[model samples]
Target: MNIVDRIWNSSLGKKYLMALTGGALFVFLIGHLVGNLQVFGPPELINGYAHFLKSKPLLLWGARLGLLACVALHIASAVTLAQLNAAARPQPYATPGAYGASKASQYMLPTGIVIASFIVYHLAHFTALLPGVNGVGDFSKLTTTLHGETVPDVYAMMVLGLQVKWVCAFYLVAQALLFMHLSHGLAAMFQSLGFRDHVWWPRIECFAKAASIALLIGYSIIPVAICLKLVGSDYVERKKYDLKAANPQPAPAFVAAQGKEAK
Candidate 1:
């Protein structure tokens, strides 16, 4: 059989795919956190960063599509491997914990489902610039000028978007779930690839947990701070700008171009 067929047919191959995709996701989490933490900097800092990313549609969209593929493959491998395991052991263990699976490991699937849902909501809330209960006028129109170029004001959007109590609550819950999922998945990633050993197993597990906690803290900070008003523009003073975001009429030149294109 070809490698592709063998991989699709074998449980071992599925495990490897899960590990590879999970690892890639782990790295992405780290990078994403780093980019997000730029919010703590001046407006120009993060504004420039976001502008740079938008300017390079190829790089931005490439990474996005790549991550989307990784998420899909990771979930598929996990589900298929789970089915194979269930088929192998039709009889249930009378006692829970009869298997050496960690409590976190036991929850990988459900948390994964929740996280997937959160990903969709996240994309809507931020990527699509949807206005929500946070009372932001229109997230898409939030903008600033840098080097004579107009760019989306990401820093302000984050603060206002997260200011809502329920939004903050949801974000915190998601981060907690992410911590649980990653803590177990990281160790499992190593063990699946045959990196787990008697001497190193404890260390591997420890590292996994530490990394998970760090990520949880990293991700949790933004929403919490924004909700508490530690970041972003002042609401009372920024009412004028809020109006601009809420009612952005298309420029005549842009409309004319669109009309020509449509014709």
Candidate 2:
């Protein structure tokens, strides 16, 4: 068998895959949090940032594709490892078990599945610029200027999307699940990599939990701020202007036909 197939078929290889992909995803979370935090800044800041990224189609898509692959592999490895452990673990002791393990660690698979579903909803809500789901003006029409160049107004999209109570609720739920998943996964990575020497393991776990909490707060604040009217107070006027500019009334069909006949 090929080396790739052999490695994939091995338990040790699956552990390594989980660890490495978890690490990649952890880094991505940090970067993503930083980007999301930019919403607290001026619209130009986040809008320009989004515009600059979109300007590089190749690099943008390359990173997205790579991240998608990592996500797939990480989920696959996690499920496979979970099944292996379950099948090998001959029906625990007769006494009460779990011994106070956190629910985050205990329910990794379910939480991961929910978080995965959230990712799709997130992509559609924000990245794909889908309308109706946002409960506001069409996201595709939400344009703003970046150095006089028109670009998708990410700032407006985020504010409007979160202003919807139900949408914000979903985001909060997703963030909670994401926090639990990250907390457990980070600690698991260290344990799987043989770092459970008892001396530094607790400290490592503490750091993981702290990191996850920080991410949770970072992501949670945006929706909360919008909901409170502290942010996006100008949403009404901004949406009207952007939608008008983006979707102006169509020219009269008879006038257009006459113009074409003249031509």
Candidate 3:
């Protein structure tokens, strides 16, 4: 067989590429989620986390570049695989094929595509990189800081954004898709890397499901809390100082390292 055939035809080769690139993106998403969750604690906490990241310009940029690369690689491989799979089977099934599986298992690809669109819209709105503000999800707002920094209040934007029923609904749905994707993807990543065996498959799959559910719930709390008006922008101003005091270093290298090691 030719080199091109060898590269694409081999299951191990495809799985290897998917596993490594997917795992990298997964780790980044978990970290991003955790950082975003800081908005729940205090404005200062989230800003301080942002401040900490900004403090290391090089590392921050490096991470962004790395993430972009990983995402590009992951998306390219996924598209190629999907196309190949579609081409490999020309005849469409007469009816829906019966395969008993959980919701997470059944809709991985469709859900992932939806979530990917959500991510793009989300980044455009919140990150201020995208051209228009309509996609801002919910939190775009004008506000003043205690130190008199005139800035858009991200926490407020989140609160206000979620207050809109449609935005909240979209966010909740996207997160649900994320949860379902992770439910199976996590275990599949490990299995692809040869960490799986028949004895461990059941246990690993259970753990993945549980972890996915927990993360989904944790992230879902913010929108619900905001919708209820249980928490809002004032929470950040009240709690920023304490957060600033807690981790004055602003680099969080130790924390990031610990988290990676734990995983």
Candidate 4:
């Protein structure tokens, strides 16, 4: 068999693939979290950022497709690994506790499935601009003023979307599950990538836990802030700019008179 085929069939190769894809997705999460946090800033700041992304269709769609591919590969590899492990041990463990698996590790698969489902719902809720799905729809027509400049009303969309109590509750629950998944996945990714030295394992695990907690807080703040009205309840009035107010166009009679006088 060719080296590629051999690697494709090997457990180690699958682990490495999972680690690489998970790492990439983790980086994307950090970027996504940072962008989402812009909701706390002036409306135009986040709205302008959203507009900027939408303006670049090629780059935006390319990134979206790439992310989707990563998610598919990550999930597939995880499921494959789980099946392999299960098939290797057909009998149930007499004492499951003997493995000493962390709770996060034990629930990883279910949490991952939940997280994946949440991702799809999230896309439909926000990215797809679906109506009545968390009150998001036609964001292009929505506008808000910030620093005297009019921009897309992303802040309002976020606030409105999460204002529904059930939506917020669901979001919080999903985020908690995500935190659990990340807490375990991060350390496992490192170990799979061969960072398993006894000297640094403790430190790696500590970093993983800290990073997961930070991410959880960062993600949770959006819904929590909206719920507490920290981000405001009333929608900001859309700034309507009148063309005539900005620059008065000369009347037809005035233009005709001017032309007659010139003639």
State which candidate has the highest TM-score: 1
Comparison by TM-score, 1 against 3, better one: 1
The 0-to-1 C-alpha lDDT of every candidate, in the order given, reads: 0.82, 0.83, 0.70, 0.79
User: Per-residue lDDT of 1-263 in model 1, one digit per residue for the tens?
Assistant: 99988987888888888899999999999999999999888878887988989999999999999999999998888788778877988888777754776778888998998898888888888897655433545666566789998777887777777887898899899999999999999999999899978999999999999999999999999999877878764742384455455346555355446435753
Residue 261 CA displacement from its true place in model 4, Å? 41
Where does candidate 4 have its weakest 10-residue lDDT segment?
Answer: 237-246
Give the alpha carbon lDDT tens digit for every residue of 1-263 in model 3: 99767866776777777778878877787798788788777666766566568669999999988987876766767778788878988998998764686777677679879988887777765665332343332222234363555444556556555666676788899988888889888888888889988999999889888888887987898778876777774554433443335444434355446434744
Model 2, 1-263: lDDT tens digits are 99889879999888888988888988988898888888888888888888888999999999899999999999998888898989997878889678889989888889989999998889988987666466664666566778878787888888877888988899999999999998998988988788788789889999999999998999899889987778876864668575556445433353345434753
For candidate 3, give the lDDT: 0.70
Per-residue lDDT of 56 in model 3: 95
Give candidate 1 regions above 4 Å deviation: 89-100, 132-135, 233-241, 244-263
**Clashing pairs for predicted structure model 4, backbone only:** none
Candidate order, lDDT descending: 2, 1, 4, 3
Question: TM per model?
Answer: 0.87, 0.86, 0.76, 0.83
Query: Could you tell me how far off, in angstroms, the CA of residue 52 lies in candidate 4 after the best superposition?
Result: 1.6
Q: Which candidate, 2 or 3, would have the higher TM-score against the true structure?
A: 2
**Alpha carbon lDDT of residue 118, candidate 1?**
89
Q: What tens digits encode model 4's per-residue C-alpha lDDT throughout 1-263?
A: 99867755889988888888899899999999999999888766788888778789999999999889989988988899899988987888676563778999899889999999999889977776555466433333445665586555777778777877888988999999999999999999999999889999999999899999999999999999987777846543221122123224454355446535743
Clashing residue pairs in all predictions, respectively, total 0, 0, 5, 0
